[model samples]
Target chain A: MEEGDRLHLGSATLRSRLIHGTGKFPSAELLAQAIAASEAEMITLAVRRLHLDGDRRSELEGLDLSRYHLLPNTAGARSAEEAIRLAHLARAAGLSDFIKVEVVGHEATLLPDPLATFEATSRLVAEGYTVLPYTSDDVALALRLAEAGAAAVMPGAAPIGSTLGVLNPHNIRLIIQECPVPVIVDAGLGSPSDALRVMEWGAAGVLVNTGIARAKDPVGMARAFAAAVEVGRLAHRAGLAGESGEARHGYGASSPTAGLPVG
Target chain B: MTVGDLEVEAALGPEQLRTRLRASRLYVVTDDLTPLEKLPDLVQAAVAGGADLVQLRRKREPWAELVELARSLQEICRRGGGIFLVNDHVDLALAAQADGVHLGQGDVAVQEARERLGDRPLIGLSTHTPDQALKAQLLPLDYIAAGPVRATPTKPDSVEVGFQQVTAAALVSRVPVVAIGGLDEGASAIEAGADLVAVVRAVCAAPDPRLAASKLRQEAAAATPWRWIRLNGEPRKSPPGETVLELLARLGVEPAGVAVEVDGRIVPRERLAAELVSEGSALEVVHFVGGG
Candidate 1:
């Protein structure tokens, strides 16, 4: 299919293959520009402080809000109830039903609470919200989230905004290989190469914020990330050689598309 | 911007833009004539009149003054249940922490702006022609304003893009088009495919800006009617003669957990198949969800 073709996941059918982040940009305008440059169909935003329309410090104040799904993140919630409450706040504020469930109990690791995330996803999904939980690279945890009616599973590469890239490719591969829903490599992606690497491994998408927002040239970096994601997705569709079998003395350009390891 | 203390309660962040953006019908653009002190009052009036999206379009104001005004206006828009936007000046927008900014062709490049502002703020553009609108469709703008549908003295030098231009832009553009310039409180603009009708003089010039905005909102509604009833308070469209059971099936809602309420009365789950609903019938499909 062409790049403009619709990407169906659960209820949404988006055009772009990439998912961008709204956090960490210097200004809302810059974030908007990067998202446009990235051509990402969906963007993630944190759910915190109730923004009053005229509040100067509120980041939600000046958005143009036209296209794309606004996936609200439960970034500060320490438990499932707190996450769900914030989810409700997001919805009451006129956000869509889709949410990115991020239940972080530990401040040091900033890692998601597996139990909290699973609990939150179930409730949100039961409320008819499309839940995409951000979790560690645990295959079993990923399976549980998917079973709990998560629209998609988002596994971190390392930590949130760490720019560490994928910490464990093996688990990511397993999650993508087994999960019924789309698998997204979220957080800790530092560069276009990191995004391309994950996509090459058959991830449905990759979410990057710090990588693009903190880059020296955010706009240029945004464009580069967009190209990398496109090329990576295209490469995956075309077929890439995997480490499935023992290599012969010589090598061909690529392996057969059959065992390319798509779920 | 320094990282906000994550624990500190924040204004609803960027994700809420989608719903607010979609629900907004009238976007009131402020003009130079409105006094600095009165701008907040004018915005309040507009919001009272149902101006859900308001923009501060002052180009000649000092940066500090602009930022200061954005603070008060943002609060007013928030209290009024509307969004506040800056016209041009992305830097001032960032400093004031406004919701978004509207940039035209000669303003800051969208990419350059992206370097300064993050993605959460609303970023929109003004397009006068079909080509500009179509090209902008590829950009990361939330909405695009097309036309001076009727030639107005507001910016006499500005080219007038008739209703046909609005139609063309709407047909090709992926984002919402706010038909601007010379738009009166009428269904004409909305009927011509304008997602919103932005007026400056009509509301600003009016002695009662609130009443003027309300009239425009009524016209915009008449032009474009809602297609679906609220299902569980969310918009859902049901086909003619669609039974409650079918909608649940179509929505993929598990019947076991679903409870139906059409209009104001409850319809037992067993009798869901017998109930018929059309376009306007309200639906409250509640279900018991796990977790807190």
Candidate 2:
């Protein structure tokens, strides 16, 4: 498919293969420019403080926006309740429909709390949010998340910020098999090859931040990611020949169709 | 040339912008006029009419001329209780210490401005299409100028993006949207759901800028027809385990007029009785603030 092809959620389909985040950029201006250059369709943001119109010192200060769909994430929230509350605030501030539900139990590892992750996903789904839960590569937990009405499941290949590549490939592969919704591998992807590896294992997409953010050049990194995702997905569609002990067929006009129709 | 705070503009952050947004309607200053000897008078008039934010827009002028003009206007706008913004001049904006800078599509990118300016001042971008608006969401823009409600005299080269595009832009934009372009009659912009109505001759060359601004404010106020009401009954604080109707009963308000929106979706009336609620779930029981 082309870059503008729709990515289907439960009922909603998004255009654009790339999803960019709003943190860690030196400035908002660069963030906007990078997004434009990357041709991204979706962008994620976090709310640090309540922003009422006319306030001059808020975190949202100086960013001029009269258009664009904002997807607010529960980035720092530890519990399901906090994540839910954050989602509400995001709605009040004008980002209502879409939310990324993230629950971190251990702040040190920043690994998702599987139990709390499922709880939050379940509640958010019941409340009618298109919940995309981020968690460890636990097949059972992945199944539970989907059962909870999650639109998609995001299983990390490695700890966030680790950039160790896919550590739990077998588990991730298992989760992919068990999931009904799209299985997106998020966090711990160190490079474009890692992202491609996860997609090779049947992950529908990947949500990358630190990998791109920490790169020497962020804009160039974003372009690389876009290409990597495209090539990986295309490779999957093209299908690679599997290795086997069976003898290989000789290359020649062995088939009668090649020499054809002498009659 | 416009006189506003470069440090305060630098210090002027997103929190400040949000507060200002909630507190007042954003004002799109006329870009056609130059160093108004009576800038304070012009801004004072706008304040009297409830315009809180002012954008100083001047196109295609020499860099030095733009700076000189921006410096003067910024000071007057600041004294007049408004935030001043320079149009499409990041370098000049930083030099003049203007509260913020607004960039056209062809101007510097948002990230470049952020790098140069840091988190100190507000940044604005001009968008004419939905694609541009979507891209704008990824940047840290405080708000968007949804333009040219009509064919504007200030920018004859730009195409007019009628009110329909304006409303659509407002609904999809991640940040607040201000309608610009030929909004001589402020009511039209407000009716089209513009958070701000930007004009040129209407306020710049008016015989009485204050009156012109006040008239625009009045029209905007009149046009903002959102229905608001205080529920006669108190809303129940959602408990860890409670259904929508149970919560309504606890609050003693009939669940008839009040509709429940959990998370972001509206819960069906039939499901309200059995739908168990949880902490952090947002349950808004909305009733009509006005109806015959």
Candidate 3:
């Protein structure tokens, strides 16, 4: 984790390679603990039902935003129009100009609506919104979002909140190869190994919620994720061992097994 | 649901929507209290503060203008994980792709609206007297609002239905009861059997609409239990309409060598996507742990 070589999204350069979601917590106090343990510099908050009177902080309030870049997400929008509107509202509410454009069209699978997401990205980018869209792991789609001026392109490893762990690594790799913007693998990641696997493939970062929040021990899970994300980045930088189809662990020629076995 | 080249996905189906409605408590219907331009911001704030279901009821705005506002408001609600409803216009609600529509006494009949809106969009009827409320119970309404519970300035001309009426509506209605009218100042509506309390100026006209809504909802009982199910023996809150395939996919379970038993019956690998889990459905997934 080179702090200087940070995860860049528009004007914000985040020190943390992993972004955490503020949802599904048993209590606001617990959520706070998980967030602190996660050590995530960027946190994703969905614009959902508010707790009026500000009596209950809804887990978002009281957080030290100075340490975190707020990435408000359009989680419920089923159309590009809906997504764009949510982005603007998020901006007006003083969350941030940076928005994670999520246009979910399928209820059953909760898959990203690729067409809606692309359209929203283009419009929001044109409107000067630092749009980071959550999209399907399609190379062409990633390029399109990048072309549309998205600050970063988020290709989900699996459906949001599913923690499926990189169902399509090939497409994700293709996105990394072609996408001009930084590729953040968002959603469907379940474990530290899953995070490491994507970082190994050169992903800019991973945004996770369910993998941490739903755990029996959320704070511990967050800490584990934080460590995993840090190591994953280091592993990517260090380079992995070379690969081959043949399985040979022992010294073959040194033992003279090839020519002197019969004697 | 295609608009130009873009595909607008349909709203939640009826069966899957039950879980959300059961959990939703506060319903905010936007009125003309705020300037037309500021309505969007107010709705956003109200939702941000905690209004569960937001209804767009722009009285004098043109259909086209209302359509645009509805789109924005609907998106805001959706982002907040709240339901968005359009008041008095089934066509507009359908056009804006809102969660559902709210019909009044003289507006389109509940049956007619249902026929056009089809099976998915929520249909809520606003009633005042006991007969209308009782009649509404006979229809296939997703939910019904019995209101003017204390009579407020928002709807000056409407008659008031005391808390007793709300209690009556709740008694006969099979669906959820939304106590509308002057509910901003009180919590007795919830005590009187109202699952949700709909408001206008109480939330929309507050100095900080978001904070006002939070305060208004302070004493309400918690919404109904979430549809929780066990996955691999651990409790998981299941969203409605979530198929076994999606659930398995989220749990990082590969279809190969993974056995899924939903409530004691094994759903073969081929039938995972077809099987939908309801509230309390027990899912036991046995996927061998390995690294290759």
Candidate 4:
């Protein structure tokens, strides 16, 4: 990455373009190792109601949570109200005011409800929370979310944990082009290549949860994703060559034809 | 609930509550005139219609009944993002886990309420005269309610302190002035320098309480005394008594990874709570934004 090429998200300047999620990992030790390997400055964590039994030490225990900027997500929320309530609960729990609004509309697909996400974003934004709404690859909705004061617009490449990878690149590209805020490609990414593809398409960053955590070698996959993110960001900033529909041979010969005797 | 519990639950600290009060335009005061069974729906409708503050004022109701009603109303206000206060009852406010208690002249002293409620809940005092309004400024109050802008049956014995008193109170008092009583439409009161307009019959007795509250809110908002300031290089009118922190909160912009400059001077993060945004003040707020 170029000097000063930091990911800025609502008062948080992050150096890493890869944001890792601490879910689906087999063990807390591995989760911590994967997090370290990923080098993600911001890690997303789901905020749920604490058990009444006072068992506060969940999988998040034994991990140095303070190391990364905690991005608490309303993952289990099925409506705008639930998402708003969860966001408040997260803030009340002393987590950062940065919230990743994910109002799951579909139980089977686990897809975010665009309207609910927008509602939560607008409400949370009005309440001084740095809102990042996880929405579908809907260009118009992404633009709307950005207009509603989302710190960043996270458009899902596909369903959460589906690993389909960039289902509608055209829509994602449109969102990135039209959105006033940074477009972060979140969810449904299978491999490091998917992360690279989105970053190369000028996405601000990529969030990998199941893609990395569920991998056979979670730590290795995290490292691979991290490297891909960095290189892709660098490539985007450096600019890529334009493509042509058809190859035009000898338009401007690379081998000097004028000086060659065979010419 | 204790103040600490309320803070954790509502996530609204005293400063945030004060900010909410300052920004409030329509305040709906519930009366015993409405049927007890329909009170929740009425309060909900009023809140949905943009009532920024809802005060439960049941003069004749028993303590037990009042507590139950207060708790329900508090939930409505909490969900609607409105401040819930109990009239003349600090204990009830505490019992209901209300945002605060609005004290009348005959009620508990402002200092006493503050001591009992602590610093978390807001304490608003109602003043009848200009002198009272001026004197109330020295007391520990979050907001000052002025007037019976016109006479009403709700408080038949109290003097009808007109719009002039609102102006007087607004001018003399440091905190936000709430113009109350006989106010159906609050444009005039807001124009008279009242930050918020509190109504009882205007909303509670309306056929459509939501519409009434909405209209009242609109009128007050239209005539609100705004302090013109340049925020992030754009000309904007902010509510009075808006500190830098309050401004940030109102805009939903957190202080983290952000820089605020007022009138060309960089305001440190710690001073944001103290730095007041005065009229014509040029404020430049820059926040980072790029996250996955």
For residues B49-145, what per-residue lDDT tens digits would candidate 4 score against the true structure?
9999998888877889989989988887887788899999889999998998999888888999899999888888988898898788678888899
Candidate 3 falls in which docking quality class? incorrect
Model 2, runs deviating above 4 Å: A1-263, B1-14, B31-40, B60-65, B225-292
What ordering of candidates by TM-score runs from best to worst?
Answer: 3, 4, 2, 1
The two-chain DockQ for each candidate, comma-separated, is 0.02, 0.02, 0.01, 0.02
Model 1 chain B, poorest ten-residue lDDT window? B1-10
Candidate 3 achieves a global lDDT of: 0.77
Once fitted onto the true fold, the runs of candidate 4 whose alpha carbons sit more than 4 angstroms away are: A54-56, A243-263, B1-292
Question: In candidate 2, residue B34 scores what lDDT?
Answer: 44
Q: In CAPRI terms, where does candidate 1 land? A: incorrect
Off by over 4 Å in 1: A1-5, A51-57, A60-62, A243-263, B1-292
Q: Which digits, one per residue and each the tens of the lDDT, describe model 1 over residues B1-292?
A: 2235423223447778756787778999998887888998899999999997899988787777888899888877876678888888887788878888889988998777766888888888888887887788667777888888888877889878798887777655556678888887757877677778899999999989999999999889777532345565544434445687876775565555334667756576678889886656777654221110
lDDT of 2: 0.67
- Where does the lowest 10-residue lDDT sum fall in candidate 1 chain A? A49-58
Worst 10 residues of 2 chain B by lDDT: B226-235
Q: B150, model 2: CA deviation in Å?
A: 0.8
What tens-digit string does per-residue lDDT give for candidate 3 at A168-234? 9999988976888899998899998899888877888988889998899999999988888888888
